[model samples]
Target: MTLDFFSPVSDLVLAHNELLSPQALGKKIKIHSEKKGFPELGDVSIVVFGVLENRNDVNYIGEVFQLNEIRKIFYSLFPGSWNTVIADLGDIKAGETVEDTYFALKTTVCELVKQNIIPVIIGGSQDLTYAMYRAYDTLQSMVNLVSVDAKFDLGDSSKPMKNNSFVGKIILDEPYNLFNYATVGYQTYFNSQEEKDLMDNLYFESYRLGEISNNVTLVEPVMRDANVVSVDLNVVQGSEVSLKQKFSPNGLNGKEICAVARYAGISNKVSSFGVFEYKPSKDDEMTSMLVSQILWYFIEGVNCRINDEDFSDDRSYQKFITLVEDQELVFYKSNMTGRWWIEIPFLSNVNNKLKRHTLLPCMHQDYIDACENKVPERWYKAFQKNSI
Candidate 1:
């Protein structure tokens, strides 16, 4: 089993756990340790693990890092009134080569996902998202990725993969499982003109940082449709994190980032989630605490999940149809959660990535816009991609 790829949590972290309150997360969840080996997974709903590979950070200068501090902080926090079973699977150390590390992560994530357990990965660099995305190769035919970052990270695909350019590799690489990619909280100055043009030319979605900061709930519908959600810690404002982790002065605050994590957790379709680009430093208490709270909110969101996506039952949802510029748009609203979804009509003549009719998550405003004879940009992009 891929569990063999993991090393047990350090003795220091476990010893620290002994001092936490009984209601703390460390005292409640199953954990891997030197004494107990691997934990039982039969009843686990969420699994947390760390990958210690960051050689591809672009600015790497042979510095080593660990997740012990983050683990200690996370374990000390009190969990909400949650019913989900969580496990700390410990860390996957950097292998002899980066490729070996990727293989281990991909295999481990594949194992957990096949068992219907969500994997919340804490990573060495944002490029590890490529490994997380690769884990879905055999499990899913088409994958939707949502990245919360300050930059689009679409570096030149011709060169080797770095944390800043891994998205380029994901798009150009083989197997072609990626169906849709969205960037949330992207800072305009961080991305180049070509990268911005590429995002538009490909029909991918990107939300500006100002836009997301103004309305954090805009992430909910985007997360609702994602299969993999990768968050770059650098997306958070520099003031909110450790000195070493400060990537931008202007970015999401702690509260906004936690809300984004909760949205990812609440998504019924999101199977794997990751927080990346964490750099260990001497004064990392604030960063650790923030990361811990992000995990807490995600688990809380998972506990609050409602199965309101099933449209087979007419009583579960309300349907509305509107005409916009000679085209008829159909919308469905969940009676349980009051969430909205717009249908993407199937094109029989075209070879479509989505073989059947699929519901694209949208806001209530999208429906209102359709009633005014205006097409939602999201619906238009999905339709355009389907036709291509």
Candidate 2:
């Protein structure tokens, strides 16, 4: 079993957990330890684990890191009135080769997901998302990947894989499981003009940092359609993180990043989530606390999830049809949750990547825009991609 690849949580963290209040999360979670063996997964809803591989990072210089501090902080916090059961599955130590580590992670994630368990991964570098994405190859026909990062990470696919270039590999590699890739909180200066052009040419989605910071709710609809969500810690503003972990002077604040995490957690289709690009430092209390809170919000969102996606019955949703120019736009609003979705019309002549008509999550404003004779950019992109 791939569980054997995991090392038990450190005794120091367990000792710390002993000091936490009975009502604290640390006291309630099922943890893997040297004496306790692996925890039973029968009723667990979320599994938290760490990956210790970082050689693929472009700036790597043999620095080692640990998630013990993050665990300690997360355990000390009090969970909300939550019913979801969480387990700490310990960490995956670096293997002899990065590929070996990827194999173990991919296999483990695939196993957990097949059992209807969500895996919240804390990683050493963002490239580990590649392994997370690969885990879905046999599980789903097509995958939607959402990356919260400052850059597109689409380096030359012909070159060796690195943290900055793994997305290129995902787009160019075999099996072709990735259907849509989106970026949230990207800074234009960090990406090249060619990369931006490529994103537009391919009909992928991207939202700038300025756009998201102005209105964080914009992330909800995009996340609702995602299957795999990967967050690069570098997306967090430098002031919100530790000295070693900071990537830019400007990025998502702690609250914004946590909100993004919560949105990911609330998505029914988001099976796997990851927070990556951690560089440990001596003074990491702030970063650790931020990450812990991010995890907390995600769990909170998971516990608050509502099953409002079933639109088979007329009683479950309210449908609206609007004419924008010559296009007929159809939208559905869940009677239970009030969330909205726009439909992508099926193409009879061309082979469809989605294979059938599907709903793209959207906001009420999209319906308003269509009523004004302005087509929503997201609907247009989805329509164009379907035609392609």
Candidate 3:
């Protein structure tokens, strides 16, 4: 039987007077409610879709999630000077089984990405990230995933799958498309020592909450190199989100999280983005608005994207080389965006995926550290991965 997984946007919600206002995003975009077909992909396009499947949440006790609460706030906000064609593709209702829902999401995401349309997924649970990651299998290439969360979410692979444990599945599963995984805003108390060691042993990257909260711009280079980005709303402080059920006492503030979202959107390589673990509360208007602004900032960043891929043009980029010990560290800075990247030398005849990726996105501080004879941690990690 053909699974009709997607439900059209409810007309009842569109009937809201505020959503139809001239300044509302709902008025400016194509909605899936009235049988409007998919938007044509031109220079840039974004398709927003929702997945309503939370059975996989480890804390699930058979509670329903109201995603439209976030949608209402999102559609009510005005957009920036964006040239991209934006569409609301409505929701993917939970399937008969969680796996069925994953299959539906996987298929949908793969199709959208193949058409060069970036998918902004609003998900019921973080485990939905597994399906999002699987969508890249058809593309038949390695992937770099960055997760913004309070926990590493790398639960035991031998155990049953849950929202908190999905990353383990992604790392150990077949097709093995994952090349690098980075967790931002992780709290040390939430993750075990074993997990921390595993992160290092696997050559993956993890940033503490304090490290990123102190300077949100530190994540720019990290996001610039990502192919997919996932945000767990729980990463934001409970005070900011005002959700007692799934909020953390210490985490990224509203501004910081939104900044991270925009950074993810600004990346030229990022194709898919997902915001998950959003448990709505009747009293929390702030949560809804914050989610709305996060999405808006992401769109704003997408509009600000510059073409920095062509490093061959000498005029477009300035090159710098630093000698540390016996190694030469080469760096490039873009004239268009002033972004910096360091070259990781490819190992000879290496059949691994890292051989395909030579440039490691870095910051000016990294270059300064290199000049001081201290090898940047990111450069060392990238070199180690390529060496393997």
Candidate 4:
């Protein structure tokens, strides 16, 4: 079905461009803007991807700005040859399916990685997260994912784009070399009883927003062990945030989001992160500029040139993780206070810290031995010692 995007709202010459104008706020949700002119990307690189869909009476206007908006937004942020943000323009047609979307997204990301440029997906839906890993599949065993959102996307079933089930399929299906995957700022209201049960069984770690607000100690490492971070914008506070199928009155604010993003960037574990689900119609006058600033924050995080104003001098992270930490994770349990916790030391991959990692940690009897012995050595030699 061809979703009727152009409403009889305003008399703006937006029809002059590819994107149409909305007559009022919170009514129509299509917010696609075109990139006006060609721009250069020397040492700087970016790829902004956007997509949208419609369901029944609801128009899923998740793409923040259309192709035209892409052009203006990029130049507006960087001004000159200081940066290059290529707009990976999504389609206006309504018949796009998951597989089709996958093909488009996979191709785009692969191209970006091939060019050695980081891709920025503004998001049409959360399923794009899977498309991202698919595009960049080398993350196996080495990748650490940090999701800053309000719900766990660790679902095993449900339609691909149904809600938060997409990432679960990836984790379950792939031989992912995932180090530590953590979900931040989850709200109790959004998740069902069954979902909670599933998460507990799956062992995917999650932190409730209430916990973070109540205790500042829990927020730091939320993005700490992560090598790749992706932010679903729906995690933001609904009172000030617009454009969505679901909005929570209690969520992260702009400063909080910036703080989290800055943390993710400084860790250097973050290669590329994305911001999804912003609807232009529901967006406030301040929305575009805020998004533009958000884009700048991302750039500042990745750039070789450092900003002392926002630089994270917290070398405490150095004691915990490094590029090679994922493969060499051998934990020693500590009976601290009342609960038992493991202190995992970071080791260089070249020095061979993976005393336990193998083709499948689940399949190895050595893993069983190590877990029981609390020793990675006994397990490591088992493969060589027991093999005749």
Candidate 3 per-residue lDDT over residues 1-388, each given as its tens digit: 1127678777666677244679778787777675454434454388887899999998899988766777787888888988888987778999899999999999988888888889899888999999999999988589999999999999998898999999999999998888889999999999999999999998899899999978888899999889889999989887887554446689999899999999999999889999998887777688888888888988888888988968879999999999998999999999988899999987777765775578889999999999999999988888888777
TM-score for candidate 3, please give it: 0.96
Task: Name the 10 consecutive residues with the lowest summed lDDT in model 1.
Answer: 350-359
RMSD (CA, angstroms), candidate 4: 11.2
Task: State the lDDT of candidate 4 residue by residue for 1-388, as single tens digits.
Answer: 1123211212232343224233221112123334332223344365444444322112443433442443234334432223333333334332355566565655656665666667666655565666666666753335556788898766655444444676667666566545445678889888878877765554456778876666534444444345567787778787555453337778877777766665565443355676655555544434554555566566555553222221134321121111221344332211221111123332344444234333211112323444454443322332332231
Off by over 4 Å in 2: none
What are the per-model numbers of colliding residue pairs? 0, 0, 0, 16
lDDT string, candidate 1, 164-256, tens digits:
999999999999988899999999988899999999999999999999999999999999999999999989999999988887889999999
- The CA lDDT of each predicted structure is 0.93, 0.93, 0.86, 0.49
TM-scores of all models?
A: 0.99, 0.99, 0.96, 0.61
Model 4 is weakest, by summed lDDT over 10 consecutive residues, at: 332-341
Estimate, for each residue in 1-388, the C-alpha lDDT of model 2 and write its tens digit. 3777999999999999999899999999899999999999999999999999999999999988899999999999999999989999999999999999999899989999999999999999899999999999999889999999999999888999999999999999989988889999999999999999999998999999999999999999999999999999999999999998888999999999999999999988899999999877899999999999999988888888899989889999999999999989999999999999999998889988876338999999999999999999989898998898
Relative to the unseen true structure, what is the C-alpha lDDT of residue 345 in candidate 3, on a scale of 0 to 100? 86
Model with the higher TM-score, candidate 2 or 3:
2
